[model samples]
Target: MMKESLCEVNNLGLRYHRGESAILQGLSLSLFKGEIVGIRGENGAGKSSLLKAIAGLLPYQEGEIRMPKEVRKGLSYLPQDLSLYDSLTALENLIFYGKIQGIPGRLLKTRGNWLLEELGLSQKSREKLSALSGGMKRRVHLASALMLRPSILLLDEPTVGCDEESYHRIRDLLLKMKQQGTGMLLISHGRGELEDLADRILTLEQGKLREKCISSD
Candidate 1:
């Protein structure tokens, strides 16, 4: 039996200005539950734009995006840049995001603590974000995104600036999420990691998407 698609983008097109070239043109893609789909492209190739559109942070001018409302309900996004509050501690940031996602305070506290511990940041949870190393801050950002156990996760260059240990930690967390039926669209320029981790690889070039098989070595 074939797996059902969790997300579908049909004939999608987006342009920054009217009558200008489309950043994403006639693109169609699908992600199935429990699958990790990697998106690869050069700079200015609209990879991030595609992710933003899927996350509903950007509007497309044409085509349709079909996703289960339930799956989108707690959809999480980690943009290429950090989204945490600089003045907030890692635990506080997770709590804040959990509240925004409507998670109960009691559950938020449990999950936030577990996440920090899993990400190797339990010791630093009380420290302000301003004092964190880049890698530590990125881990906190990722933990914030995982607070709600989102059904669908959109990660844009999540491993950027990550140290080896942090990179493996994030990778393991993503794999664990995939096993728990969380669909993901991971945008990255790192071909080696993409090849190893992505179940299906999509390459965007000149406003088009093409599927490529990746050997997970």
Candidate 2:
């Protein structure tokens, strides 16, 4: 069976200002549910810009990004910075984000607990973000995103600063989400994470996305 496509980007173009060089142009991409796709590129490449456009955080002048009316309501975005609250505990942060995502009050508690436990952060549930290690913070960040049971996830460098165990936990959590039918678009510069997580990998250069095979190197 063919999977349903959650997002469609057609002839996309992104520019900061009129009469300036385009940051990205002639880009098209499709994301389907129950899949993981990775995009890799060099420093100057517009990988982050592309993610911003897809998330509707940035305006695109010359293209269209279409999502199903029904499915549009359940998309989650995790930016590169993680954007977590530094002073809040992991549980508190999850509750805040769940509420913001419009999850029901009682349900938020249930989902938040499950997410924390599943991410192997049950012990750190009450730990302040400032107190938790880098890996635990990343897990908390991901927990916030999954709180609303999103159908698709947009992740940027999800395991960048994670320790070995934290990295495995996040990777495992992603696999679990995939089994339950969540589509994920993650960007990473390293090949190890992409090689293990991505079903399809693309390299972005000069505003173009080219499919690429992961090398053993």
Candidate 3:
């Protein structure tokens, strides 16, 4: 069966300032429903910039990105930096983000509870975000992103600071989401991580991207 395409980027080019070197150029990629595409690159590579462009956070000077209305409406971006308030509890943060997404109060409550339990953070749901460890905080941020049950998920280093258990839990959750038909673009520096989670892996270098050849062994 042919997979449905959720988004497409054609010949994308980006630069923060005029006359500066392009952070990304001539990049083209397509994401299919229920597919996980992994991007690997060094620190200075334009991986994050590519994601931001797709998320509509950055303005690109060249090329075009096509996302249908349904896909755009259901898109979610989880940046490398956690975007939760340290002053709010984990549950409170979820509620806050849900409201911002215009989710109904009752539905938000139900969804938030389920996400907390799924992430093994139900016990810490009411704990202030400032008190949570780095891994716990990352989980909370992830839960907030999942609040929308997005059709397209852009994850930037979702397991960067995660411990062994946390990493496994997240990996499992991502696979579950994939099974549920969520197309994802994940950014990571770890080749093993991508090999384990992504159906296709692409490496970004010098503002360009190429497919990574995996060993059959």
**Which portions of model 3 miss their true places by more than 4 Å?**
213-217
- What are the lDDT scores of the predictions, listed in order? 0.90, 0.87, 0.91
lDDT of 1 by residue, 1-217 (tens): 7887889999999999998999999999988889999999889999999989999999999999999898889689999899999899989999999999999988988999999998889999999999999988889989999998988999999989999888988888889998999999999876588876799899899999989976453
lDDT of 1 at 50: 93
Off by over 4 Å in 1: 215-217
- Arrange candidates, best TM-score first: 1, 3, 2
**TM-score, one value per model:** 0.96, 0.95, 0.96
Residues 76-115, candidate 2, lDDT per residue (tens digit)?
Answer: 8898787789899899999999999999898987898899
Q: How far in Å is the alpha carbon of 26 misplaced in model 2?
A: 0.8
RMSD (CA, Å), candidate 1 to true, equals 1.5
